[model samples]
Target: MGKPETVRLVSKEGFEFVIDYKAACVSNTIKNMLSSQGNFTETELGEIKFPEISTPILEKVCQYFYYKLRYTHCPDVIPEFKIEPDIALQLLMASNFLDT
Candidate 1:
């Protein structure tokens, strides 16, 4: 792609993340967002809040995004992310929070 275009992505839980539109597209969730016209909340300067994910997971995802973004320059397969069963419960809570 030429300089990558801007894209908007929102999680099922209602968390909207505004990274480099290209960077965000690295996510399958986002790629699908681009394919289908999904509802997104936008403000000036492309500010977005991804409430679906907590600060912790969002932080981790962001880090992973950056890594994948640069992975082409320095190729290496990294392990997939996994969370504890108990923490998975908290994620469920977070997901429910966005729904309600």
Candidate 2:
């Protein structure tokens, strides 16, 4: 697969993350979107917006996504990170976003 284009993604809680199509492909919604023929042209539907997640959790989510991207060969175990309730909600939002 060639390098995909960078795209902006927004969470429902108003958190926005810039990710490559491949990176966002980790998200099932994204993957499903790509699975279709006209996904590339579908702009409005592609941005992920998770309303329940707070900024802090979205920060953590971005870090997690970075970590995962940085270490593709790493183990599957999720590292334990202390987070606030609001952030935890964001984590859950990201988890659900990626369907992991």
Candidate 3:
């Protein structure tokens, strides 16, 4: 089957974020989920559910994915990736789990 242009990521709260496939691949874990040799359900459906990540954290992760994609080649002009203090710990945990 042809590669999907986008992927759906579902947060623990059931919020879904549809992001570009290239952007989603910024996370090594997600890249593996979609491209691994095993028959991953995510590979077939192009969707993944993060049960440990809340909506807000997942949203930030999605944003970071796009940001990383946009600034990957341009090292000089990359902006800081901001995280709100309230969710900073949670975001870090999620990022670690996702291997982003």
Candidate 4:
């Protein structure tokens, strides 16, 4: 079989996340980056770099992307996404930057 479609996201601290394209596209910003009409670097390389987002926040954003994908259409109840109080502000900023 052909290789699965994926995208690489790099955080400011050099943490890299390799995730399915479908999952990554859960974020509107990422979807546009990957599928924009113009020829951008991210589209060509299948990678996005978050220079202002830290590793922990980026990790949580990635997790939320997958969680949103998995639970979006489920009939069962979806669990809340947990965030530590300390990182809440950072996560919110990252989420805004990602347009999640």
Among these predictions, the greatest TM-score belongs to: 4
lDDT, candidates in the order shown: 0.52, 0.61, 0.90, 0.88
Query: What TM-score would every model get versus the actual structure?
Result: 0.46, 0.57, 0.90, 0.91
Those runs of model 1 whose alpha carbons end farther than 4 Å from true positions after fitting are 1-17, 37-50, 73-100
Cα lDDT tens digits, model 1, 1-100, are 1123553334545565446766765665554444555454332223345655666555445555666787657657765656557556666565344331
Clashing pairs in 2: 10-48, 11-49, 11-50, 12-49, 12-50, 12-51, 13-50, 13-51
Query: How do the candidates rank by lDDT, highest first?
Result: 3, 4, 2, 1
lDDT of 2 by residue, 1-100 (tens): 2224755556556767777766666656666765677545545344555566566665676666666676678667766555667456557856786674
How many clashes (backbone N, Cα, C below 3 Å) per candidate? 4, 8, 0, 0
- lDDT for position 91 in model 1: 60
| Top-lDDT structure, candidate number | 3
Q: RMSD of model 4, in Å?
A: 2.4
Candidate 3 local accuracy as lDDT?
0.90
C-alpha lDDT (0 to 100) for residue 18 of candidate 3: 91
Model 4 clashing residue pairs (backbone): none
lDDT by residue (27-99, candidate 4, tens digit) is 9999988888888878878888999998999999999998999899899999998889999999998888778
* Lowest lDDT 10-residue stretch of candidate 4: 1-10
TM-score of 3: 0.90
